[model samples]
Target: MKGAMKALRLHKTTQKIVDGLKLETVPIPEIGPRDVLIDIKATGLCGSDIHFIDGSSILPKFPTILGHETAGIICEVGSEVKDYKVGDRVCANFATPCGKCYQCLTGRPSICPNRSMIGVTDDGAYAEYVKTASSALIRLPDNIPFDQGAAATDAVATPFHMISKRSGMKPGDTVAVFGLGGLGIHAVEIARMYGAGMIIGVDVDDYICERAKKLFGADEVINSRKIDAVAEIKRITGDGVDISLEVVGVPESQLQAVNCLRPGGRALMGGLGAAPVAMPNTGIFVRREWEVLGCYAFENLEIEKVLKLASAGRLDLSKTVTSHIKLEDISVGLQDLHQKKGYPIRIVAVQD
Candidate 1:
């Protein structure tokens, strides 16, 4: 508990597949006055971490610890911290927004340009211990498991923000969610939670599509590789869907998401692909009155709400997790995610 801890780290960004990360013994970070030291219990793998490892610009810098979805028990608190104490189970907001920023002042702290995100701009929870600002931590309720608590940071909180704040999903709206990854799977659950009349989940893998329908409350499942997603969606819901969420941020997926929307529908984009998107003619957008919105991370309030919901059994996301691994098997987990070896919604790395 006092010395070095095992961690998976990206020494540098690389194009070579799975070569960017290495298991290293690093010192447990020391907490500052406004920070707390967390003995991480669980951390979920994210697609963005793959981008960071593969030399993508998803992260601001390299040679840093890379995990955002995390939950743990507090082992130590800084001198300035008082509301929390040792042995407290908690998950935290991934970034600490500068309260003085214009976006923060405007009540959009998730988009604050000056925010410092865990695993992107600072050392993250992939290691045995992580030091984070006290203000970012949220206590996990007694009933929620640590992995589920970890998932609240991104998997649940993100889609909650998108559906509740960005997409304007209503009680009976039809929704098409493209990409059944961690984020997209949650999109389905959240859509159902909001009383979606028809929830369609789109993914290339047939297994994922099946899981989305059987486990995640998706009313319909579309295999993008087998059929034209946009056409199928239009056929399923006459005049297109009421809302479309593009969880995969590639140009093609973005276009498909836009194309699958009704004339006056909204498209909420959450993916972070690097390629530039080609939009339809300006006149088409003008004529249709379709709205396109971009969603970033999540708000602390939303994360707290999701945690509370999960704790109360109102939101059941335990089925979304596919595998639980140890810190040493990170490469295998990353490989499974990268190669599409299995239709894994989430692969969590638990502390050894």
Candidate 2:
């Protein structure tokens, strides 16, 4: 539990790779051209890892390492790497982006035609070391905790992408978010930071509902199982939310997301449910003409914005981290995660 370290890995034919975690004596990663080798300080467990574990995620080749949200210290850099050096604290954005792709050229690298995420197509964190493109690594401030930096990509960056870049949110917009888990909490905080007038947080669990208002700054919290989320949201916002986000992938939540939107509003789906998305036919297009979309991962601008928020201390993300475990307990942690049992604000796999 001390030195070189262990990791949780998956190597199935398809990406629906389960956790085939094992202990091995591996050397520190070597930097490739345009790469930097990092001594991983912290890494966050993500919902996408859940999809991949069940063999339901999009992946390139198999035999990949898990744990994507990474924060670490630069240990080595390739000869060609620039703007960074050894001893820098860093976090990564594009796990792997094909810079020549059309999507990359358009400054929408999140949708890059040939991008591959860590722990999906390639080896990721959950190890003592990780290597990333120098361009993908952003220097982290000393004020950000190692665990928060590890989660910067998921808890901070991705939601910033949805609110600041993708949502086109202006000041005083009303936003409703479905799910009070990690990403849902992030959505709530990010919406508040964007000057949203009212933030409606939703979940089936009453604990989450209570937690939303107390910790995440949600102006209103709803337990969808007992109350009609759509009607309640409309009642609170008085016009339905300008933007409604589904951070939980349950079929019921998805259905409620469509109804939660005001006419001509937008519905953004950021959760991963491992099932096909189904929406009403005439009810959506004919009645409201609402816009429905999905966002995966994030881009550089959002990453920078989130880092600034963390550095300046503008966001209330205190309730998000409820647990931590060393590499030895990763299997137990993964099991708890699979069941959604005792949802943690941030579950970090770290070196002991």
Candidate 3:
């Protein structure tokens, strides 16, 4: 805990991710009385990380390590931490919420105004070591590998939160997932796991669309570039889908998500976009009783539930991890994600 460790630090925002991030030796994060120090074993690259690099997402401070989806071993424990000890395998809930805040007290801690997010608001796990509160830690079962455990933290958990908690997707409901990226692709799998009657995946990339159908649980896939996705979805489902999740974070995809919903159906927006999305026609929306809800990241307990599901073999993340790279090659992974080079579902940075 005393010596320096190598981390990929973001000095500034740049379109070129490699230019913005510098891999340098920095002091290991010091722990507080209620904190724990982790030796990062596996971490994942996400679309939000790309958004930070492209200036679409804003960071509170610069020179911060940039990774939130992580799993590791506890190397040190704080004096006041009672539940956890060193050498425990764990994955973290990146959002650290203030327990006394109004949102936290009301059981909506995911949106706590006082919440601090790892990688976004503070130094994260794009390094050899990272530190977070003991409350943010969730025990990882021995059956799960570190890379799968890391992906479960965000790539899988976020969509599970959106579909299971926010979307109101009942068994046998028709579901449509927009964007076949990391989060969206997982949405397809979660929808199927929840017993969706039909799961449709929408994306511009043909490769991702095909993979979602074959590997993930998508029953149908639509490439928005070649055809009218909304019309096709309506034709397939007979009156649009029961639940539509927009994880693309773009105005067009968000609008399409709303449009491809049945009357009184829900549209859960999980993607974060800098631009304002145009509101739907008020007359039609009000008449149809359509609901558009915003879903933030998963709750801390949800991460535990996801881990249990994975451990029980109810959820499969085998294909979710597209590839693995070394910590030094994080920039390359980010570039590959940004360029959609490999149609990656989740590219993880694992210990070499």
TM-score versus the correct structure, for each prediction:
0.96, 0.92, 0.98
* Model 1: per-residue Cα lDDT over 242-290, one tens digit each: 9989888888888989888899999998988888864677898889999
Candidate 3: worst-modelled 10 consecutive residues by lDDT: 12-21
Query: Candidate 1, which ten residues in sequence have the lowest lDDT sum?
Result: 54-63
lDDT assessment of candidate 1: 0.86
lDDT of 3 at 3: 95
Tens-place lDDT digits, model 3, residues 1-352:
6999999999888888767779999999999999999999999998899888878888899878999999999999999999999999999999999989899999999999999888988899899998999999999999999999999999899999998789877899999999989998888988888999999999998998999998887999999999899999999989998999999789998989999988988999988899897558899899989999999998878889888998999988788898999999999989988888877888999984
Model 2 lDDT per residue over 1-352, tens place: 1245456566553332233455565655666778888788888877667676666766676656777888888888888987999999888874667889888888888888688666766678877787788888877888987778778777767777777777888898888999888788889888887899889899988987898898778999999889999899988877688898888788788878888888988888887886777577875566788888888778766777787877897864445567788765665676676667796767887753
Which candidate, 1 or 3, would have the higher lDDT against the true structure?
3
Instruction: Indicate the residue-level lDDT of 175 in model 1.
Output: 96
Off by over 4 Å in 1: none
Two-way lDDT contest, 1 vs 2, winner: 1
